[model samples]
Target: MVFELSQSASDALWLETHQQFMPVTSADGLETISKIPPQLGKGYEREVALQPGVELHIFDSTYQDIAIHIPENQHPVQFMVYVSGVADSGDFIYQDANWGYVGGSGIQTPVRTFFPGAQHQVGVIVHVQPHLLAQLFGNSESKLQPTLDVLVPGDEQPQQVFSSPTTGAIRAVVRQIIDCPFSGVTKRLYLQGKVFELMALQLEGISTPVCQNRMLKPETMARVQQAAAILRSHLETPPCQTTLAQRVGVSDRTLRRGFKQLFGTTVLGYLTEQRLALAERLLRDTDLSVTEVVHCCGYSNPGHFAAAFKRRFGITPRQCALGVISAQS
Candidate 1:
């Protein structure tokens, strides 16, 4: 149940099984992630160095109840976005559909995380070294102001979790990072750009009214978030407006206003965007055909789906798929 992050993937696995950290070998350097034990449930994990001192971890899992202890190196400031499901870190419970920002130093503090079973959670974790922060801020910490400063005086300075509701802009960029259609140095550049953009969106949202509103009524916003999760869970056939509101224990008006306020989109509109985004992912990552993609995205007519797809992305699904082929070839 204890996991350590040393220098490489193999070292992490060793720490998990042996309860001790070890030197990272060349093979460990080549692989970027610790494989999730089967008993923990099915999942894929990836860790990649997008730049010196910066690593991004993407984990998508459908697991049962579990407790995991993670080592606190106190070295990197961490940022996360829970694409879905709740993340229970013994210190704080970060609910689904939120952006999390943790900046501090570490002090050998044992951190534990819990995840309930049967729910699919997609999360992106970015770890940044202080040196990289200095570089990003023009070699000065003043530019980062309060956000970059460690909360604790010493030790465990890096593990304080600051979480907030995710904005629509931040979610879109995260999807792009997860679904990037590139490899090699190009993929690194792509991911690094999205990471920067994600941070920019987080900064821009700091002063926005939506962020403030989220803080005002946590319970109500959470209900709206429930409606959102419902939509995502049933993207191909989501609940109707009234049914959704009723299910979430909110009035239709509250659901509408809250959805717009919290997510920057109406319920139906958000559903549409989610469908299209999933379509984009399928067309890019899988061998799904254009017609199948359209059907899966909840569109009955290929022509209509094609037109809307082209409008949103400036190219049809076929064209996008073709471009993937051309690039790979």
Candidate 2:
């Protein structure tokens, strides 16, 4: 089946189809298949539907940069994730005109003069659901302010592009999705979870000072701060690096480096800390059960939340809330 794009809510767009590339020389040969309006350009933030029971989207658009033209837009901010590949817009995001890796090999750095076009084949993209977006940034009725942009590689101690070790973990998850595209309801839920995780990965770094500080470079500091602000604005659902990068004109690698050096952790890791911290506060201040706390903390998995809570506070969520587990003897 072919993927189709449908209007979702006021600001967000939804794709309910699974699509994959058919060989250019295959039986049905077409030079270019324009799914979105042509005037908007070929890369007009569009979603795709691959084979049967598999619907996915890879957003590669500058629509956010031109969103002002769309009428009655209720969405706050627009961003996309650089899931499992490399992207480089010469003189666009990176100052020196460099190419950066999103979920590719090596340190996700940006490149320019020589971009390894589509180095990897497997990639995944998911549009931010409108309801989720509204829930995250409900305060503002109009457009929300811009946050984090694309991140690129930087010159630091570890000499890496990303801020923390969790960057690698995020990449691993992206790669897994590439290897195994989900199907049916599973794919829908999987995409939702993956998109959420991607946002969390981006925010994870911002929640911590060290990682956030890494984003304090001369040319790239603004983008980093913007990204952080965006994440901070939406505690429920945050935009991914690609969308963030495209809107503000920066490479995901740059954001990663700055976030790492400044905050001392990966973006996703920092986001987790924030959520867990909030959960902890609720556990202490309120009488919510661990399950309720898990949902309140933006986690759907109680077991996972419990384990993470224990790891963070040296006590399970229940013990922490009930004062059963204490540091003092």
Candidate 3:
């Protein structure tokens, strides 16, 4: 199917295309989940209002080849991540683990085409109001990082579009959003935190020059991603860099460079970040004590773990467990 629609006509567009798909709203009216029509394909699309100025859209489905033409219009800042499938716009093509940022006023639009494939197209799109984004950066007086200046562009600044391969850390966060295990207000709070996390990852990616300029070969990038998966699967005893490089069939040097370029961090740095993130989740959701959480996250010294946890999360494990802090805080 092919159609043309304005960026603001989302509800009307959805209604026109999927007449059979009914939106089921949650009890609190904060979320709506709609299944794909049988004739179109399989799976569903979920929309959540995380807060007054932030929204989350999660889609997982497969269908016949489709093309959508978006007319020139103003748009909110959007962070888009695709876990699989292919989307070809005139100037850019997005595929598995690809992410991009698009926003600005009075910008020309592209004809985005999605091709049918064996695997489902799954991912999340986060929309944040320009003012909210500015507030998150501490208002107009705060200096925006050079790379992210486009996000809050001046009236005369041209619209900007940025795209890149996502890091393992980003994919992990995306999965957490897809499989969120909470409901009601807790669910909104959790997803809101994740939306910000996604924004932070994109901010980190753009801030680093190497991430913008250094493009690894597809095979090498795949190996680096594999190495990351290994680290996540074995957080308690991740392989050493040399061993990991060997396992992924990349040289140690290549692995190091790839990690920096694709993930914006060193191998060890990424591992540490992931471990600390896991620790935070455990402290919040599980009944694990501080010491047990530390051990589960592969830390030995309680003092060292507490220090690192505080550095990463701005709160100690005990504080997080006691509900003294939230994911957004």
Candidate 4:
């Protein structure tokens, strides 16, 4: 029998499962004695550990159609590996955002993270810090999009896709992070190196190598990225762009232009988009009501929220929550 989970309550469930699997800290070293119990009809499972500074979560399939709400415009640059059963049906849709197709099919040569927004079901996700990835790439300024709706399946590169050898190397680093036994600052350092190697690979494929000898410009870019990060870090109560600019040491004009150029949206626009994306994900993935979702996304007026949502997505939040949104290709 197939099971379904309520969108509203599943977050608590996710948190509960996360806490249960986390390792207990001791004077000796970081030891993970906890193990996830196998569920009924469980085909495969593994207990993985992330480098200490990074946190990891393994979600069960109680909710077959799981939706994650990433309220920030940027997500941790993550590398994912599928270690088990095939995800027969699912696509990471990039609805208000942009995404591209990455390669992955059953029996494929275990490709590294080459495909942009590659679609899959069963896989491991690695969340690497952007600064770390940038340093590794020698770019000094880098930001990866956080919210990917659903991934398209195809060998052909889709619109807004970012594919390069560097991304693949990041995938390799994820593999190493999963398989290696390094810890402490050493682990972070090695991971940084692996990430750099990944970026280098990406550079190999790019027709225009702008990153070459571009260390001087990264300082300004890094500040722009830092401002965006501040917005994301406070997603619950995200501040205005003016405040964010002051904190990040960039002019409001610079912040606005930089985010638009890099992320395809203005800073405030990106924040709103993030909130709406989070609301949409919760609507589908959780059991939250429209009113509850309103509060969750930081909107006080449900009617205003509904109108804005419809304008951006062509359907009311209610319609989406009812699973009536048309499937995109």
Candidate 5:
């Protein structure tokens, strides 16, 4: 399939292409599910309005090659997470396990191509109103980072695009959203919570310092990456900083400096982030109890685990498991 259309006109095009395909809409009209025409592919696409200003698009299908051209025009802020398949969008490439952000105005026309095959193209796209985004990020007196500044643009701001590999935390949330089991109003409420969770994660990921390890020697960068791997592999009982440095064939000082330069955080910071992320996945996806999750993720005290979990995710471990959204969240 090949077509050129404004991003806003995409659904109309889909309807035109599959005249026989009837969309199934919820009673409240907040959710619509459409199946791909058998002649075109297998699987389905879902559109859900999580709220008045936030919309979610979930696509999961194996289709023949498809190309879409989006012309220069204003666009609402979008956060996209691709789980599989390759989509080349001009300067930005979207592939398995990656995320991308698009916002601002006057974007150049980009021809996004989806390769042909049996592979499933699974992904979630969240469209947020500009004003809602601004409110979410807050109106700080201080200047926003360049990457984020472009997302909450004024009338004259230029176009912006950003992409990065999805972090474990982000992948976990995406899995939760894709696997959401509820239906009807219950499903809508569940999705609304997950959407906010995803938005928070994406914002946190983008607000971090951009990697600036280009100045580091190749060998040094390699060692730093090795240290990160060691941390991930030993989340339950990670080595001390000095020991981790030695394991990666680097001095303690070098390890610390490398982590800050390459990852924008210290070794311990990275470890804690990874641990909590793991705990979050466990709490949401597994039958593990809060206490078990605490120990599994290396927290000796359940109280401490709950505190840290709530601090990092805006909801306690138990609440996360129960799909309860706190006011703070």
Candidate 6:
């Protein structure tokens, strides 16, 4: 499946191999995935920018037939979020706001595919250059260095894979990026600010106490991922510990251990984080009132929601919503 960089290769011949692909990179940096295809139904368009160490791609479209294959190879550390749409790269799927991944410097990932059908899809892919990786982890060459220590030079596969739902702070900032309502220098400044905010969120995820020496088996990790997915599906009403464990085919003890060892957050801690993240997005993006947002996120009372939102973003829901709107203006 060799997709042309300038245009979409005809799908009939393209899917003969039936292989999915991930974004590829050359020695210099990430190569362009593809430009506008001829049959861009519902009119697909993208806005891209390479601002210093950061690169951004916003794919908003309803093009259903084009086969997207980002050939795999060494690329910079990538953090992608699905603002809307569903993509299938083998077993992994990407969905709005709730998804995030930290791919290491040199790994051969498979071809990634997105299934937008006849509906509109929106997503943002952020690439951080490897040279910036050094600065991101400070000037340290020690084991304390997050990427070097965990992401590693790598062996046959990636040493560390941090893929999970993002926090509300991240969701809020990314929405600002996709909905950025300015152009020229003002727009650039706003974009730069949001990009850095994303960086900070990824940093927090990567900084989770490195259990470099500890390893959880692949099976257990899969269960942990399944558990997280279940939590995502039930954002309005998460399951209890025993129920969640049964659903994922794991004991509560094992589930807790897997989360800490593999995902770097405990079960309830991860759930609370995910809930607050969802609530933050609801408040900032939707017209849901504080009470509705609270109930929708499975919180019984507005008091708890306000406190959690403030704890996570340093502001109440109403304040954050107002602040986000002001920044957008």
Question: For candidate 4, what is the TM-score?
Answer: 0.44
lDDT of each: 0.64, 0.44, 0.70, 0.46, 0.69, 0.62
TM-scores of all predicted structures:
0.51, 0.34, 0.57, 0.44, 0.57, 0.53
Q: Report the poorest 10 consecutive residues by lDDT, candidate 1.
A: 22-31
Sorted on TM-score, best first, the list reads 5, 3, 6, 1, 4, 2
Residue 121 CA displacement from its true place in model 4, Å: 11
Error of 4 at 137 (Å): 7.0
- What's the lDDT for residue 274 in model 5? 77
Give the Å shift of residue 172 in candidate 6.
Answer: 1.1
State residue 208's C-alpha deviation in candidate 5, in Å. Answer: 0.7
Tens-digit lDDT track of model 3 for 157-244: 4445555457888888889999988888888888888888888786665445433553565345545656776676578878999999
Residue 244 of model 5 has an lDDT of 85
User: How well does candidate 5 score on lDDT at residue 150?
Assistant: 54
Task: TM-score for candidate 3, please give it.
Answer: 0.57
- At residue 94, give the lDDT of candidate 5: 36
lDDT of 1 by residue, 278-322 (tens): 788779877989888888888888888888777778777898877
Candidate 6 lDDT over 1-329, as tens digits, reads 22232213545432432233323342333233433333444433344565776888777766654446655556566777766655544323335555676655666455555454555677677877766766665456443364444444544553234554677777787789888787666777787778767866765654443425335554455466667767865778788989989986899998988878755689988888878877777777678888888889888878877877777777778986675532221
For residues 177-239, could you state the per-residue lDDT of candidate 2 as single tens digits?
544465566664665566556545544433344343433543355456446545544445667
Ranking by lDDT: 3, 5, 1, 6, 4, 2
lDDT of 5 at 10: 58
The 10-residue segment with the lowest total lDDT in model 2: 95-104
Give, for candidate 6, the lowest lDDT window spanning 10 residues.
1-10
lDDT of 4 by residue, 141-214 (tens): 33221112111122332212222222444445546644545766565466555544433443333312223323
